[model samples]
Target: MSAATATPARTAPGATTLPVADPAATRRYAWQVLRAHRGGVAAAAVVLLAGAFAGLVPVWLVGRMVDAVASDAAPSRLWWSAAALVVALVGATALAAVARLLVARTFEHALADLRERTVHAALHAPAAHVDGAGTGDLVARVSGDVDVLRTTVSRVLPAVCGAGATILLTVGGLAGLDWRFAVAVLAAVPLQVWGVRTFGRRAGPVFRAERAAAAERTSRVLEAVAAADTIRALGTAETHVHGVEEVSHRAIDRTVAGMRVSLVLTHRLHAAELVALGAVLVAGYGLVGAGAVTVGAATTAALLVHRLFDPVGILLSQVDDLQRAQAALARVVGVLSVPAPAGADAGGAGAEGAGSPAGHATTVPDDRAAATVDVRGVSFAYDPDRPVLHDVDLRVEAGEVVALVGASGAGKSTLARLVTGTVTPTAGTVLVEGEPAGGPRASAAVAAVTQEVHVFAGTLADDLRLARPDADDARLRAALALVGADWVDDLPEGLRTAVGAGGLPLAPDRAQQVALARLALTDARVVVLDEATAEAGSDAARTLDAAARRVLAGRTALVVVHRLDQAARADRIVLLDAGRVVAAGTHDELLAGCEPYARLWSAWHRGRTS
Candidate 1:
């Protein structure tokens, strides 16, 4: 409940962390965005400075009117000062509004460019890096941190710019009225400097910790939500709920600590302002009494010092916001720091730097109609110490469907990912039609569907069109029909029906059908389906299997299957155990000849019958 009661947050050991750009890099990236809009920034600055000066005119006029009354000056002079003061007030308001508009437009353009670059970088980033960092961290960076940065840019940026201009111009006016009035304000400088330095020192680590905690909290919440069904099935909902609460509390604690530091800074700043105001008033009295300056000048000096309170408060409070923004910015820029995997951009055959290491041909060999997958002595490990796959080898000829049958963690999915170019082999090579699995050509040749399918928030046609942007409504319908998604006919709007979040909620089976339909629309010559039907019910499994058969027709395919029936239909079945291919043959051959395969099939049969 209280900031003092909250403890500092600490990261759990082995927690996933996405990259974070250093402070200098963050500043440089920000400068680059600003530099691109320098014309607008310059225009805003000039208008803001002129507005700040215009604001001072009213204070000057009030001081002149005071002198005029004291001296019994002509009434016409009073009228003129009053009229000039009103015009000055009007000009300041108009100029300030224009400056704000300019600032918003400039920063908004920069923010849009940054947002685009961040998304582009995230899309092109290495799959392994993204996976290792976890979806929450990436989502928080791209969505959460980006939003925070956007607010800071749109709101805080303009406010800070205006406040800074007003502060500087007001200080100049104070000196112009009487130099000692400016000197008196310096009495508070030491405290202000100390307060800022202390706040920065204390707030930086806490805010960074707060951000990390927030990311972890987001990751936990996302993980729990994603696995909600599994968690309920396992009767572990309470455990997951507790995990979310624990992380949420950690985030709250860090936030509270940050607030505590900010409060301390605010108090110190207020104290400094009081000291400065007292000194200014004392200087004003001394000057007026000594005949060094008139009462009007003294009043003007006090009024100018008082005017600083609002802008100065804005400047100091924004210091807290600035720290938070910088932290978000560092995370955002960090996304851009992830380098694309080597050869990711190597276009069709013999493109620059497309050649892979010896014994591996990652480049496109030649453009061909039929696609074959070649995995030669390929080994891979998510962790080097714990290899998921060993020196295994396999090949699928064009139009052949090879089912990879294995128990859990047998590297079937890993192999499928390798073939699909989602990952690379640590040793040996994976090639699609003699092109490296991850190279541009091979990537275009391969399309995959896994158990987890996402239906983007859009019309059915828009979702299908992602696979082939040029696909017309006829093609989309054909693809959907080919996948046996008759449910489309039941939809209120057919191909125009909205799906995904905020639209028609699709069942897992229907979503997978959409994914398969998208696959049907692609011209991919190779397909990898990793437990693509694992989530379907028995009835739905048969439907999905039928749809998959139609989609995989005449394609080099690797299907990772848990159900023995799916493997039974494959042209050849590859039974993987541990990290090696223990058996490879037709279903009958494996059942008759391989003890492991026979036992697996017998167990699978028993389970199905039971």
Candidate 2:
């Protein structure tokens, strides 16, 4: 088929996404993330500034009225001044309300964008990287880390911006009233700076450590839940519990330490405020005695200096929250900065779309006559020091079924992953139909069904439709029947029956049958089954094996052998010992000449006989 006729390649829901780059300097990235909403941010700032200056009007008017009273001014002037005070108060309050709502609305918009970007990044990350990194790092970031940033945006950000604007306007007003009082109050600036700088430096590291501790704690919890059955089976429940307790202890210590640092900074900020207020008031008294300023001027200057306390304290108090937000933001930006895989776009564009760079798209031609998988000099490692698959060369020709037979940890599954473009090799290349297997177009031509199967919370038809959303009820039923999932017909609602969490429960074997049914719906010419029948009951394994034979009839198949019987049915059996392909032959040929294969076959036969 021509490229124009073939389906456009898509990142399948379960397909691996590009790996994120290791974090670099991120302040610029943070700005870029925020820059998308600069219009709203600027609007909020303008409203807040107007409200702040309006708030100063009442203070200025009171001084005017007091001075007029002292001078025995006209009754009309006094009444006018009093009336002006009321007007200022009303204006200030109305503007402040509008400003508060604007700021909140802006934050709501920015936060929605942030949350969506974060989710897409997670969904798009390579499956192997996500597995190796464990749930802890991501779980903490998605939950606690996001919440911390939310606090900064909704609360700390507004406090910082509003308080900063108010402080500047108050100081400027005081200078206009009397420069002596303004200068005295400004003397407290150095103290505030010292308090903030010292707190910031100390608090950043502390809060970062706290976030790390939280991740560690979360990891333990997730692992315990994931392995609860295994732990009980192995009589290691107590050990797991103890590990969780230790993690919890560390998390508690970090929280207490972070709180202590914040408390010390808060106390110091209040002390600085008291000193600044006293100095301004004492200076105002002297200025009045010197006849350089009127009593009204002294009063106004004192009130302005007092007004400075609330906003200044607010600015200082939010520093700790701001520092914590910075740490969380670094992790988020790291997710966004992941480069597209070589020769593939990240997605198309926008929130849900990711693609390779411009003009770099390449599609695997839809030529079923030559759908082959090639792995050349491929090497892989979960950790660099411990390689899983060594320098291996593998090929599966069009219309061939190859069985990879190995004991556990022999890199059979890893090799299959490479062939299916589920993961990139640490070294060397995987090509499918002459294109890089990891490339977007080539990857779409392959399908893998592994032991792990998820039944999304929906109808049975909904689960079937995940493979080909346009598949009709008749097509879905045909696919299920092909895969030996007969129980679908017996369900209370047939294909319309609800399944997954909170719905009708499916056994492990039934779930694997559902997975196979979905696999039967795909158009992939190169198919991989990685221990796909391992979770099935013995009877279901037989059913699945029969169904797999039908699926593999004319396609290029790489079968990671979970059942001993599957190897006998393959066109070629590739035996792997450690990370190398030790032997390749038909099942009968391997048993006749290969000692390693003979021994493995003998053991399996013996187990089956027993």
Candidate 3:
């Protein structure tokens, strides 16, 4: 197992892991959430305090019954005390249930808001950052970390709050009976504090490591699963499997280490409880012997000290859980720290009616006629020392189909990404409708479909609605029909059939048809088809091309062509060689005037004929 396997995709060359919120930011956001539900918080606190007070009445009443037996008091008095103790226990139970409910109701509202904001931040995150971070990091935060925080808020948090209240009130009851008994209980504080401090210092880093290792394992697994076919084809399946195993082992080791630390803390807390109980017993015996207090008062003090056991244990045990919750909270909120794309609303609340859930909102109205693209002196580099495209310029007239042709690594897809606003140029400008590419205006006007299309897991209609949320079923069927997806009728429920991962799996060519259908539903005037037919088999290529043509009919299109025949059919072909446009013309003109084009055509013709 290599070190690289432990780090996974986040530490890949040129990749940057997404940011995590600092302690201060996490605390601030938590306070903001609590403040939003101040009414509920106040109500929960009052109910909990009342429950704690009621819980102590039983201990005091038991002490009174002991004194009555020693002094031979009236039987009626002992009976009344016993009756009151029963009533107090019942009252405590009812108040505790109500307090727990109030705490959950109050905090759940804040959790819902945080959940929404985290999702919005993820969807609107800058494309460049998301590309570098890998999907595993995002998936872990939204899924695993969110679940952890949700459990903490709904269950563990209320327990801690109620336990704390009980502990404080019980300690006060000891003081009211006799101040020396309260002082005796203070003997436990030193050991308890040491235990918490030691656990905090040791467990924080272990839990954090566990969370990170879990994310790394997820990344390795997803990478292997998504590229299963490619791994098998290249005979590198063993390597991927080993990578996943290494990350899994690391995660397991961290989890075990955290558990060991928690066990050590529990032992120390147990010792603290023993020491406090011994001190309280000695104090009660001394006060009763010297006549410093009555037998009833001493009995009350002893009972109060014993009652501290449950609440104190509960409070101390929750320390480990709180550490884990804190780490998870930082990761979930960290996504919100990533900046949204240029011209997007702060916190990813994009303008209303921005078609898709994550769509960038633009102030400019749609103008199909003005949708001409111009790339002037555009240069790009993923790394500063290695330039991919140098001083490349190209243009596409409104409603014209321009094909970008090049050998692999000649920057064909890179250039298409720049024109479609997936990436910004390192040196120059990419303009659509006279405004900068990747800005609000350009993003609103442009839509893109690549060979790597995703069919979301849902009813077919829900997946289609992502592009045009308000679109009716008739419009969805029309778009699907236009793209030649006649297979929908064969499904058991037509448009209501579930699709995508774990659902009915569609062939690659059929999935591309769904992509084209979505593109058709958008009002975008400019469309980019980057190797959209590259994954289609020879038998399905013609069908996909026809679908691509219909989708691009009235839109200005920039196609990254893989098949030479597709380039030949374009209105104009721009051939890039070694990051430069070496030739641009009609297919026949290029063959007549450019030797490179003639050679490429001859080679392609030979491959087909052979």
Candidate 4:
């Protein structure tokens, strides 16, 4: 069987092939996330310490009240002790509330900053890098994973810190008052700690699997929703639904398994606490009988042991939450680690000189744009051992229009990408002016409008401003008009009208118009239109073709024409067979000399006529 046929169907993005967690890696990721918010971490530490200190006051007050009662003090002393206890409890509660508020605020702000940074990193990454990563996974990292961090920093971590500190202080206080009772109260601590350590190791892997499953489920749901129309047309709605269900089921199973481990740990902790309480009671009674401790002291020890156990239980219970947060932190850190694309600033004497000729000035001119694009002995393969474009040699003059025409999958789009600085040739250099074309200036000089035009969520004015942020209203209108979008002015809000999702949805033709308008706004010296008008109907195509020709009146353009009529109007038509340019000349010259060109022209003409 062929390799493709032998392989099983692809699993959903974020699916885990193995359910093993690395505790060391998880700890490292958690530390990185915590360090990212130095200010928040500092605030959390301060809040936790203060809360722990406040919590200790109640235990101290309970001991003082017990001592007073056992001594059979006067009514005045007894009443004073009761009032002091009340005051301590009230003060502790107030301090805890303030600390909670401050910690929560700091954590939320830090999470917001991290989320923004991750998004910025993803946006600046190279297109090829982004294509390798799944959009759904990136989205989950920003939205869901960051949220988990917020919860951990704000709710779980502080509680764990405060509870642990409180337990330690309570134990110290008890030991100072009566050593035997204190020792008995902490006798089961070793067992409890051992159980926690054993289960904590398993918690990390189970939680990681659970998070991955949830991310896969989310990706599937998003795919199904986005392609609902295709699913309906292909009668594959049920299949997609089943895929979603499978992911959901796996997620539920992982979550339940993690929770089951957590429940066992909780039960063990509770049993340990009960055993410690029993030991404390037994030791307290024995000390009282031997006259080593007062009756009230023994009572106070039991009460204090019970109170300390609450925080201990709370600390143990939050281990699962901490594990989940660490898993999330790993995903977030992974996203932030993606390097951004390199580019040149608008600062060079040559670029400045070139700009001055056109009345366009920049603070810096890109030296790379001065280089010539030389694609000599170039070859490429998206997959190893399966070359697509091979040994291709092509060049264009400083001011020349080169139209590339070919059958489907002829590597035309890949060539355009090579020229636009999106991809580097595997075997040869793609130079811009003379330098290698892999920087911002080269990208700016060589602009491309692909078949799919992305319209961001914004007003019409906002969309136009993307091409030239400082462009005035007049410039925007002029560009729109140049793309034959004169009807834009007729909209109710004109330039202010919303244009993307949650706004007025533009038809495919109108979207193409917007893209062409953007190209005009860029005013780049070299423009590559890779089937930019493929989505437009025939009538709209003709109008757009005329606008395109007018827009390229004096500029260098590489037009990838699908229709022969459009190719006939280009300055030169270059026909490709396999990966090499087999014919290059005016349309009539190609039709007269090249059999492939003539057949393609005849077929396009018939299709257009029909």
Which tens-of-lDDT digit does each residue in 1-610 have in candidate 2?
0001111112333322222222244556556546877888789889889989999998988888888989999999989988988998998888877877777778778777877876766665554656565667777777778888888877788778889989989989988987788789877878788888888888877987787778778888999998899999999999999999998999899989989988988888888888888998899788888999998888888888888889988888888888788777766655555433543333311110011212223322324443888889989886666788888888888988999999898999889877766568899988888878767666666777777767878999887776666678998889888878888878999999999998999997788778777766666677788887764337778887887777656678888985667888899999987898889999999989999999998998887788
| Candidate 4 wrong stretches, greater than 4 Å | 1-40, 179-182, 344-372, 550-554, 574-584
> Candidate 3, which segments miss by more than 4 Å at Cα?
1-12, 346-367, 501-503, 577-580, 595-600
**TM-scores, all models, native as reference:** 0.91, 0.86, 0.90, 0.84
**TM-score ranking, high to low:** 1, 3, 2, 4
Residues 62-104, candidate 1: write the lDDT tens digits: 9999999999999999999999999999999999999988999
Compared with the true structure, the alpha-carbon lDDT of candidate 4 equals 0.71
State the C-alpha lDDT per candidate.
Answer: 0.83, 0.76, 0.82, 0.71
Residue pairs in collision within model 1: none
Worst 10 residues of 1 by lDDT: 1-10
Please give, for residues 1-610, the per-residue lDDT of candidate 4 as tens digits: 0001111112434222211224454455446556776776677667666666666666666666777777877778767767877787787777667667766776677667768877875665444444434466667777888889888878886677778767877788788769887789878888798879988889878987788788778778888998999999999999999999998999999989998999989988988989999999999889989999877778778887888778988888888898788788766655555544455233111110011112245312322222235677777655445556878777776656778899988878777777766556667777666656656556556566776777768998888776667778998899888989988978889999998998888887788788778767664666678887764347887777877776666566677877777778787787777777687888889889999999998888788679
Error of 4 at 325 (Å): 1.7
Q: Which of the two candidates, 2 or 3, achieves a greater TM-score against the reference?
A: 3
lDDT of 2 at 518: 74
| CA lDDT for candidate 2 | 0.76
Candidate 2: segments with Cα more than 4 A from true spot: 1-24, 64-94, 126-128, 338-340, 343-370, 457-463, 486-505, 550-553
lDDT winner between 2 and 3, please give it: 3
